[model samples]
Target: MSSNPESSSRVDPSIVPLMRSLALELVIYGPIVTIYFFLVLHRTNNWLTNIFNASSTEYAIVAVLLIGGQGVMLEMFTSWLLRRIGLRH
Candidate 1:
């Protein structure tokens, strides 16, 4: 309700770095994740299908492990990349 227009247009200074970090992460992660999935699917499709056909429970367990491993590896790789690029410490 104030007369000052500047206050309405202002962004929090503290949020700028966070926004930049998120943008950078998205930009970097998008293609890397896409390529990762492409390669993994390409290489593992037949093996995974065979496992699934042999045992549903084994397939479920392997799927969970693969997902968990992907998450961990992606995080590690992203962090390392960011550090190497001097964007993150």
Candidate 2:
């Protein structure tokens, strides 16, 4: 049998304020995150070009690194921003 809805990841209706705060944070950070990633990638564009010509194995490795690296950096940024603004998650 399936677990109760409260245990699910879906947003709970009782925490509208929390949801609003998160939505507000995303609105503020979306552009910043996108630009930061773009600038970081732009600075190492020669590395990017090399990757495009890489073998499949190398491409897989680079893909994992890029995704994981960006995810960690963005998560850290979001955590710092939220904490700085006194939002607790």
Q: TM-scores for all candidates?
A: 0.67, 0.62
| Each prediction's whole-model lDDT (CA) | 0.82, 0.80
Which portions of model 1 miss their true places by more than 4 Å? 1-13
lDDT of 1 by residue, 1-89 (tens): 55878787975567666677778878987998889778877889999999999999999999999999878987888888777666642
Model 2: worst 10 consecutive residues (lDDT sum): 8-17
- In candidate 2, which residue pairs get closer than 3 Å at backbone N, Cα or C atoms, i.e. clash? none
lDDT of 2 by residue, 10-29 (tens): 75455766787798799889
Which regions in candidate 2 have their CA more than 4 angstroms from the true location? 1-14, 42-46
> Which candidate's lDDT is highest?
1
